[model samples]
Target: MVHEGVLVESRTMRASVAEHTEALDRAKTLSLLPDGMHVTTRMVADYFEVGIEAIRSLVKDHRAELSENGYRVLTGAEVESFKDLTSLDKYTGRHLALFTRRTVLNVAMLLRDSIVARHVRTNLLDTEQWARTASTTAPVDNSVIHNLVAWLDARIRETVAHQLGQHDARMTRIAEDSVRTVIGQTVVPLLNHAIRADDERRREISDIRREVAAIDRALRARMPVGGMAAMDAMSWREFEEHVAGLCRRDGCVSVANTSRTSDLSADLVGRTADGRTLVVQCKHFAPYRKVESGEMQKFIGMAKVEYTADIALFVTTATFTPAAVDLAVRHGVTAVHRGLLERWSAGRALQVLR
Candidate 1:
């Protein structure tokens, strides 16, 4: 009975060895890991040619064993430190889970549902056995041994160079994609916002222009025909006020009479719609009287220097002398005579003597 039991045990052991050998042969045909043995959970999934969720499920089932071996969750400064060490910007954040070689092997051993994981375990076992045998084996011929070593060294260098080139190209593509995404997210919105603001401003300016046109039409409709002739009958102060009123009706904003002060060269000061300072001098004279060149020259000097007026107007109920008209033209002064004053007071557009 003892002899029969020993024979049955030997057969069972042989069968187990045959099964393991077959698994190793099958694993050799599969790509179980990347070029480098170091791996993340995603990397391991890619190595086994399985979905990432499948690897995650495996990890969830055998978390304790994997953690005890080499599974680690990097936190705080460790996350930054690991990214720096790997020279990978994509790895830069807090609370990242990393898997070492031992952790991967442990997970593979514990996985019952994944054929890929079983293949990975077999590959790992074959690799370990090969390493041990290679270490123990002695070289029979020195020349042959040296040749084999040189060939292996060259192959290793070639593989490393190829992997590095691929890695650099992938990183460049990732960087370009990231820049495009940022421009789409940030620059496009900013440009749209600027366009909208500019359009709104233009609409506001158009509305203001329309309103000003309406106000000017109303002022012209309200003006009297013989207003300047009527103004000639008033006092000097009243004439100044009349001129100021005409200026206000003619689109002069902030019009104020300053005729009471002898120190001021202008009877009225105002600003135009286009933000220009307007200086006006009212001359309430008789119809036949002519404004002299000397008065015009003095007023022109004051308007240009003291008040820094963009436009200067000399208004008279009478007309201007030939010399005075010449002087006003030369100094860029507007000499408004009886006809223009009448038209202006009646709310017609002022036609200055150029």
Candidate 2:
């Protein structure tokens, strides 16, 4: 007795009945942003009576299906372009995800455990039921015209069956031949032309890419050696970003720069390719300054004791003092001093830590 539209658990069925998006309005009001055409992630969360993170998680899980129904993420230049279009100047984030009406309804169908979503499904079922009842059951008059209509229907059914019953195989063959003829006349030639042109363009693009790569290699050869001077001139914030990029380049997954986090200031966190947790605290100091033993001890407490990292590294532009070096060796902390950092920046891996 359950309708397919009410089966919110099935994504396929939900998408099939996405035209019933008006059911969302019937269930509850869907407030849109200034544009009135698209809704932000926050707006969608508010409509569903859920948290913004919940909406983000749902989008991540059903990305492809939701994208097909017009869910989209805008970033960088695209975000700016959208801001200009919508005049939504309040948003200053790097990324913005917008949802169309169909996309929100799609979420409703896929979302469970929300009273609002349940009400939407109920309205969807009602719409389907109303359409069926309204279209299929027309009232008839009890008169002579009714009898004539019934007699005509019976005669038409009987005559159609008698004439077409023996021609079923011939009809099927005609339908298949028509389909093959249409495909041969249109689809096959278009496909062949498209494939040939695409292959030729691909070869030309490959040649251009190779030339660009050669130019990039030549440009790099002319740049300053090791680029250590550039690091010394960089600001503290820039240094933190540069070191995090190095960690990412060395086959680290989920490498994050937690410079703003209070627990570990200017820390690079990720897991190595071998599945060991790596934590690096960057010290963007002058090469003339030396890291003292007291600073090394504090780093050990934060990186090892607090973070419980498998590979705890203290990377600095300055060299460690003799006492600091001894403390680092005793505690198994890989102290990446100025010399080691230069080698690392010059494309050498931190094999000692691994």
In order of appearance, the predictions have TM-scores of: 0.35, 0.40
Quick one: how many clashes does candidate 1 have? Answer: 0
Scored by lDDT, the top model is: 2
lDDT agreement with native, every candidate: 0.63, 0.74
In model 2, the Cα lDDT at residue 295 comes to 89
Per-residue lDDT tens digits for candidate 1, residues 175-214, read 5556556655876576566556656656655675677579
- For model 1, name the residue pairs that clash: none
Question: CA shift at 45, candidate 1, in angstroms?
Answer: 99
| Candidate 1 lDDT trough over 10 residues, lowest sum | 28-37
**Residue 22 CA error for candidate 1 (Å)?**
99
Per-residue CA lDDT of candidate 2, range 226-298, in tens?
Answer: 4655688788888888888788778888888787766653378888988888888899898668889988988
Poorest stretch of ten by lDDT in candidate 2: 136-145
